[model samples]
Target: MTSTQRTSFPRQGVRETAIAVKTRFQSASDVLSDCLEEIARCEDKIHAFNLVLDNQARQRASEIDDLIARGIDPGPLAGVPVALKDNICTREIATTCSSKMLERWIPPYNATVVAKLQDAGAVIVGKTNMDEFAMGSSTENSAFGPTRNPCNLDYVPGGSSGGSAASVAAGFVCCALGSDTGGSIRQPASLCGVVGVKPTYGRVSRYGLIAFASSLDQIGPLCVNVGDAALICEVIGGYDPRDSTSIDEPFSGLLDSCDKGVDGIRVGVVTELLAPASPDVQAAFTKCTDKLAAIGAKVDEISIPELSYGLAAYYLIAPAEASSNLARYDGVRYGLRVAGQDVESMMRATRSAGFGPEVKRRIMLGTYALSSGYYDAYYGQAQRVRTLITKAFGRAYESFDVLLSPTSPTVAFGFGAKQDPLDMYNSDIATIASNLAGHPAMSVPFGLGANNLPVGVQVMAPTLGEAVMFQVGAQIEGLAQ
Candidate 1:
């Protein structure tokens, strides 16, 4: 039997492969073949993808080879194999958010980012799993089942973007797209030992994304390293007329910005962010911060008191938006619908059968929060708190070029270790503040912590500050290595 373990695969990532493909050092077909083989070897064990489009990937590779045969450059991400989170639609593909409701639902068009990736010659392997409607922190909530961490099969690969991060760490794909509503991307990236980013709101178009929280959701990349993350970000990010939230910002040359170094940069270590983290994580965080100082960065502990309420605010705000956005799935149109005596009954039956426990829980919580007489007490207060968090982030950035903290409170935990929902919510405590603030934040793998599982240090920058954020990340990555 072929070994199911994924010990190693091609070290050359998105950047190296693009260079090799262009120079004839490696044909796109040959490179894709190697990637496919690795995916075959690992997917069964890791459960990284909701679907593996082997034939489609192979066909795309041939097309890229044809372009190279005619001496044409297929843009920056040439021939790179990428995995997209299932929530990000691809034309004619099942854009299920790992929910049974849309299990057979296919999208008529690709998301703006998907189109961008295809245009740049990226070979999309398949759609990775995600939480139902982008809710939940662990992949466990997926109606399709959980994505096991490649680092420890018994543990979850942090979630709702668990499969996206797992695919990169397991070598199933070089990069993957995932949306962050809270710490969906960064927390999972930390657990799975990869670079995961939540770009500033509006930085990446959400036209193709199935919404969970319109105000908080932002699509970003999970990659093997900081430079790969930067490359993927530049490719999929830009202004899009289709998405009302798409900002008119030039996203050129993010890779060039990565090497700017951290010398003389100011980094504020948020004290409150660290207080919730486990001791093992705190130690790893200190080492990473030390590396920044050694490289001439000015590091200091800063307090953002308002940030303490961020997770509470996010739980209210995100679910409220989710309840509203998800209302479209009321069995009146597309997705799974069960027959009933009348339309209302059919709709109620379909939703009851379609949604998982976590999703239903949030919908109820959100509906209650948005209901009359309770809005101000819950959802309204949450929005006010969100504003304070945003201002708090701004206040920190005033004295610092970037803020730093442990991406998660602990390393990947065993399935069911966090049985209580409250316990699971703490997993994202360190990373949620930025999402609530609509600022860009990323999780950079620093080193191993408990059980030798990876620990990631989060670097959050001001709005439109991804360039400098990546620059510091590249530096931290160098030290960790």
Candidate 2:
């Protein structure tokens, strides 16, 4: 394993870096070189990157510099180096998803978000590591190896977007794109002490994201702060014709509304979240609410009874979808294939050999749930629970502008602390509800806890209320500073 215990890298700002490049205050080439230099310094210790497209990054930077010399505006994210979670397609770039199944497979097209980022002038730095096909909470399930926390190398970075969060926290890049299914993005961002956002289902196009659970999967941004997150959200969010599930609404004024504090905003503290969080995490959350209250926000406790059933439903529903989605990865189409007597035998051999243990476990669980005899008892019932969860959120939103909770029950834990699947499942307890309800939620770094690891305070909004979420998140960030 690489030595991940180095001192935390000073984070870079997405907006500031873009501004610097746009104004010629710093050349794009110089900025990218600095990023590469920083990556070189910590890449060994962090192992955050799965593939570093150094030459491509340099060439892109040079092109941006030339555009600037001609007095032409590139885009909002101009010249900013951004990391992408490996599951996202990147044209010919390798997007392994940190799994051996796709280790040798390269996509022929860019994911919608990748195209948007490139169109907006953000330089694609490289593809960061991730949990295999966005499975597992710790990222330890990755076939390539685990991504360690930058805060303390002994600990694991939260995942499956661990490397994306680690890259930002390690200062390898200003911002990175991560797809959230359950707590994939927020949990890791909380552990890494950065901003992580999961837009409402359909708020961002999921056309190119390799599906973990089609209903729960939403791609969002992990960045240094709320401002950066809001900026990226605005840039990538909107309707996409290719995505049938996409909402036609555009995410307007995110950057403008993002800095607004929670003054007079009605923030609800989820009643159930208190029990699952550690005392230290509870203390951090209390302090954050107190700070918001002191700043004139009205904070109150609200009950979302259905939230208690979230985890149980999520495991069943997500896996059921995952089993269906993963069915396409059989030996016939692409990725890894092991020799066998014939087609059926070959498909069986490939999947058995290619999928990691965690993935296989889920596949089996999902397949069993979707089986004729158990479908209604498991999968059907789980969807009903999801509807109830969504209704609970809707009721809460009637009285509260945004909801708050600890992003995770505790902070970044040691690698082997939660080996059992049940133990690992606890990590996403605070985040699964929002995914179930298809609501926008974010994890904002609140402060350091007694363990010295970062504690994140989650802010959730109603289906298209990202503006409200970011505004409240900004207030939480203010408390931390």
Candidate 3:
């Protein structure tokens, strides 16, 4: 038997696009041109990117075509176009984290994952907008502007990885990179109707990712399909000497596992996580689990009460880390310096002028939590709760190969729907537990909910369980079709 010979460029999907370009069935330049054309057509309305690398992407595409002409393989991602969440450093490219503080800051080096993408022949399209310092659940916190959901322009794409998910949903790129802190990646992927992966905390290197919450952040892929997400994860995952937290393990065969299905696997539906979901989302989740069971998987409902504490713990821990990480942005160093009489006043003025409301709110919350008398009551307690959640998840995994839940409690809501900060924070409830547990999790678009907006069903696995996670995600994706 022989594989099908492609004669035209694949309109989507990372694997097909890369194979089509690498096998000489499609030109890298042509693929890039199509992406650029799409960007020009709708980017104004979508506002998905902070900066689009038109010339650089064109030049890179040409270089890949040249490599293929010379009979050298350009690597797996051959000519697939990819977007990066602005928080991921890209050497000379400005990495703003969608915040005014670092609006003009350019790194001297690329993130480990960025370099990996280039090595895999993925063209760099642009940097996508995100919540200011990944502090919000909606892209509305962006200093530049909010990214609207591609599924329905009136609604928001979830954040702080909103723009990355929007880019994939809008067909601006084959896939995009997003850093998941709390529910940044998965929640947005759910809202945007795309596939988003949050690999085990250390499964992918965080060396060049501008830290929001050092311990909770993980860089992952936002793609149109599970297969593309798996391929990108495989390309970017594995040990990195530069990242102290990077897992010392080889990451491969993930793409191969996509077709393996979930037959005979033990799947658990997290009861507490599902309790808060909207009826529409609950319905979609029910369908997702039923599909899994019908496919020969052993599916059952399981309660992990400790997950209820995840939201409170994440808020305290992530912000405490953010308060420390963002300290370098003071006027004494670089970016958005506000003039004042002295260094002390200048630093205060600069932070006041540079940070958005949401960023300031989190910073204050973090500072207060870490303050002299409150550390034990707030930050320390949060860390203890994190340990509890991690242990609870470990115990659940002992009985189930994977856990299931709705990625977000509701479908993408209209802009300004969650003006109150607490309301905004609640959006991440279902997804935060995975970040807390340092486990692998993914959100695969299951079906539509209220107003025909997309709903995502989350598949979570124990640490280093990406292969099984992808397998279940693929099965759910198949059901959606």
Candidate 4:
């Protein structure tokens, strides 16, 4: 059927329909096809999708149609189109993490997050690109190439979840899943002008996601709006027996809190974040704070002195964990293999040849940090700093219901502008502390910046305090509108 004709068909959630036959007015196939067509139209410019599951998506749509015809409910997200970060496993799709090492590997099983989305009747539209092993701040580090910012092609979409953010920003999908180890999700969402949430660590199971830093990694929703993010989180979150770190606590009323409003809420503006941000970002944040005050929220400045050390500490700790977690991909066990005379040589050659420059840089830094001579100087010191930062957050949370900061220090930059590795790493400075503290944080589009690109205001709450985060985020979202 023609794209125009298919789009004209009546639509229902994938799970809502039970018949396989396409109706005169509407069908699941129609909705899926239209979305696919939209993706085709813009994906070239955005470079968001790594692999488009055209056939598989069509088949799922047909199945949903049959189910609806049978009068069976497909469930909340049934047939809804959702894109997944390439780092997240999908049965036969290549979950590359935008790295050469796993370029040809297909996961044998779906990740926990992917499974939940599937159960909800969501169609996997495609795998989105990301920084190799989720190690960099810009999508330019991806083996596949960078994902362009939808708002301005010359600028970035943010990373390591850059592709996922761009896909949603470009309207390629209603929502997408991105893994955030240290600001990956929130940074990109902010850059792309979309809603992105980084759930408290352990809130979402990390079973099949390619590990960056196991302790800090989280899978969350990137969507067009806060409500969409909340909806997707409801479907993918909750305890998982398979993930030991997964909290056993019942699902928190995250969605319900969205409508609760932020009246009488205590919002803390971190003074450290304000000083370093560009004037535009600072102004945007100030305007947001004013809006909160107008809405009856008590806005106050709170200090987290230790947060200034977050970026340095996170770089050390995350890479240390990542070096260990990624060690398993040696030539013999799995992934790309390099033939050599001995086992050691084979493993060395494979890794050296497969991993991207950014990944290698991190692995080397991590190895050096964890190495015998420097362990105390690097990794140990970073851990101690982390403890201090965490404590500072704890103290701040005690005084304030939520903490607010500009999601990024600056607006999106040109793809390769931050060529210096250290410069790129610093891009995550403002958003990394929440990851260290394992708190729920979200990025909401607050206003336009110097380049006319979107600027985001990040709202963070104490551990497992997503309900409060949502309330504050919803308030900010309302103000932005």
TM-score of each: 0.98, 0.98, 0.97, 0.94
Model 3: residues with Cα > 4 Å off, grouped in runs: 1-11
Q: Write the per-residue lDDT of candidate 2 for residues 1-481, one digit (tens) a residue.
A: 3454557574569999999999999999999999899889888888889988899999999999999999999999999999999999889888888888899998998888999999999999999898899998888988998988888888888999999999999998999999999999999999989999999999889877888899899999999989999999989988999899999987888887867777789999997976799989999999999989999999999977778999999999999999999999897878999999999999999999899999999999999999999999999999999999998888898999999999999999998898899899989999999999899999999888856999999999998998899888887898899
Q: How far out, in Å, is residue 145 in model 2? A: 0.5
lDDT of each: 0.89, 0.91, 0.91, 0.85
For residues 1-481, what per-residue lDDT tens digits would candidate 3 score against the true structure? 2121111121489988998998888899999999999888788888999999999999999999999999999999999999999999999999999988898787889999999999988899999999999888889999999997777788899999999998988888999999999889999999988999999989999989999999999999999899889889999998999999988988988888889977799999999999999999999889888988998999999999999899999999988999999999897766889998988999999999999998888889999999999999999999999999999998999999999999999999988999889899999999999998899999999989998888999999999999899888898999999
Candidate 1, after superposition: displacement of residue 458 in Å?
0.2
Those runs of model 4 whose alpha carbons end farther than 4 Å from true positions after fitting are 1-26
Worst 10 residues of 1 by lDDT: 1-10
Query: How big is the RMSD of model 1?
Result: 1.6
Which of the two, 1 or 4, has more TM-score? Answer: 1
lDDT of 3 at 8: 17
CA shift of 252, model 3, Å: 1.1
Model 2 residue pairs with clashes: none
Between the candidate structures 3 and 4, which one is better when assessed by TM-score?
3
RMSD of each: 1.6, 1.5, 4.8, 4.2
Residue-by-residue lDDT tens digits, candidate 4, 157-214: 8999999998888777778899999999999999988899999889999999889898
Clashing pairs in 1: none
Candidate 2: count the clashes.
0
How much is 267 displaced in model 3, in angstroms?
A: 0.6
